[model samples]
Target: MPSLSPPPVDKPSDATTAQTTEAETKPHAQPDSDEPINSLDPQPIDESKPKSNLDLVNECDSFPYFQSTPQLYLNHVSTYYHLRVAAYPEITLGYVLPSVAEVLRGLEEWELDDDERTLTLKAGDDEPTRSAILARTTAAMREIGHFSILKGWRNELYPVYGPAPARDLLFSIERAASALFGIVTYGIHMTAYTKSESGELKIWTPRRSKTKSTYPGMLDNTVAGGMATGENPQICCVREASEEASLPEDLVREKAHSAGTVTYFHIRDSRAGGETRLLQPECQYIFDLEVPSDVEPKPSDDEVEEFYLMGVDELKEKLKAGEFKPNCAVVLLDFFIRHGVLNAQNEPDFIEIVSRLHRKLDFPTA
Candidate 1:
């Protein structure tokens, strides 16, 4: 069957137009009154060289910038904020609360110091109440158009794991920004593999539904989702298995095995503005399920479009061809490494690839 491509949906243009108008109205003084004012001319463009598969893989396996590090390429000055009550280092802001004004308006538990631009949770606020307060704030942001609900579910709190005594919760989807605040967001990814009658290994992969806001139509693991508040990694794996694929609870519970984890820190441009950046520090709890040869996965939820059982060799070729989602590729790479498909002798940069798979994020534990 021919591949079905979903129609493209245009992003809302109102905010962009408003920002452009505001920027245009800002007064610009002529450098020299004596000299005729000249319009800014566009500079010549330098063509970028194409990246190899190794380069692309390495690019995905990168670390987030430290708060103290300068991002000179940004058009505007970047600001770092900190939590006043803790000795945590300054954190670069991302999507959750863009500015101090919004932060003050949305969260009642948070106290913001205008002079220092730091925010802190109210003293003596317990975890249960803090979670309740954040949920209310998230709802208000959604109502006022500051945040969009993803996947049609109410915003959920996700746990941020640290070294010892430090534990906190942030909205599940907003964990990207939470990570920028030096928190660790945990998730789960499960791969279903089977052996064909001819004795060839095959892996089941799914195409993410096009309705997904991020990485729509991209290929993904058989089952995956963020570990939500009050949910353990194993429970998350079983839940995602049933949701993303039509796997029965008994099958998932019986066949799945803990396969280790993949951790990484990634930085990317934010939708808020060109100068804004998103820091994502994440760890995925990996699970492997060996299914019967005759059993095939069917999409049970809107998260997955279709499932395909491809030969291991074919999956590797597709992975190298950049067909899978960036993070999903990392998960698959981890699988290949463990299964002996990828080795130091076969892949050039094996040590670097393995090292980058586990990034050391400086989560504030003190």
Candidate 2:
């Protein structure tokens, strides 16, 4: 799990140019240049100093370069192209930047609809066919050096579900490439805590291994992971609890409780591999487990360095200090909100913070 450094994009040879199609000649599909035509990169946030509770929330839900206003972030998404499949006209599977749309022209499978302002993937109805086409096209993009984001690609697959209420599986995409497509990805995050004899609450937090490709050496939730293509939240939670935190399946099943979800649209920064400012709409299924005092959480894999049992006050200090991963910080904030720790009486931006934590996504989700 060493830090992933994207391979340098070599200039395309004459043979590579021969693969280009008529779609490349379209107005939106502009050729690559020394300088970008329309940059979709988001404004930067200073991560060096201590931030307020609201500031931490803004870090994960960061968007709308003009101001840090939360509502504007949602509005900003309108500017991106709607990513859809041919049959599913009503459902938006993902969002794509015009810059990304131009890159998709390199792949033969994707069809760009100029009138609809969409980049549609051309494939059949079957999941296997859609998955295979996406897999092949993304692999081709990786091989041809389409974008740096694909370089951090995990071989793992993330499902892009069709409609919100139905949650039908549309297709699957590589984990890293999902951000490039601006899709809604799901994950599971659990906050494991314990109470002393006096009822003083302490939560378990883990530090990610420094060798990790993204967000190395950062603080994460007690147990967390991405929900694979067919995995449900509860199963993902139990599995991650075992793999990441060494908590036994029976223990997790007996003690862990689903606490709902924390949704946020995050823009990647330099620490996240590949192109900075790529959009990532995520929904983390939240769980809370009050472990028995004797049950100590330990790192079961290289993904984590160590686990720390921190008091509520200490956790607050670390959160404001910007010590946790951006999305994980939002997850922790949700935990505080749910547990009545971060209340309206104490936090001034209580209402705003709560709303942003459960930010409504434009794309269909589970």
Q: Which candidate leads in lDDT?
A: 2
lDDT (10s digit) by residue, model 1, range 1-366: 111122232221111101111111211212111222121111111215433335545445444233322221111111223333222223322212224233343344566553443455553345555445545544443344432322233345566432345444322334423433434567899989987678777789999888776667878988888887678889998998887788988999988999988887554333212112334557889999999877788998777889999887788777756667767888888888888878988888788778777765444321
lDDT of each: 0.55, 0.75
What is residue 293's positional error in candidate 2, in angstroms?
1.6
Go through the candidates in order and give the clash count of each: 0, 0
Residues 1-366 of candidate 2: C-alpha lDDT, one tens digit per residue: 111123343222111110122111212322233222233455435657778888988788865432343333323343455687866764566666656666665355678765555678776677788888878767766776658787777899999887746778888989878987889999999999998999898999999999987889989999999999888888999999999998989999888999989988788887776777678889989999999989899998899999999999999988877789899988998988888899999999999899889877766887
Off by over 4 Å in 1: 1-59, 64-79, 83-102, 105-108, 113-117, 147-153, 161-182, 197-199, 268-276, 364-366
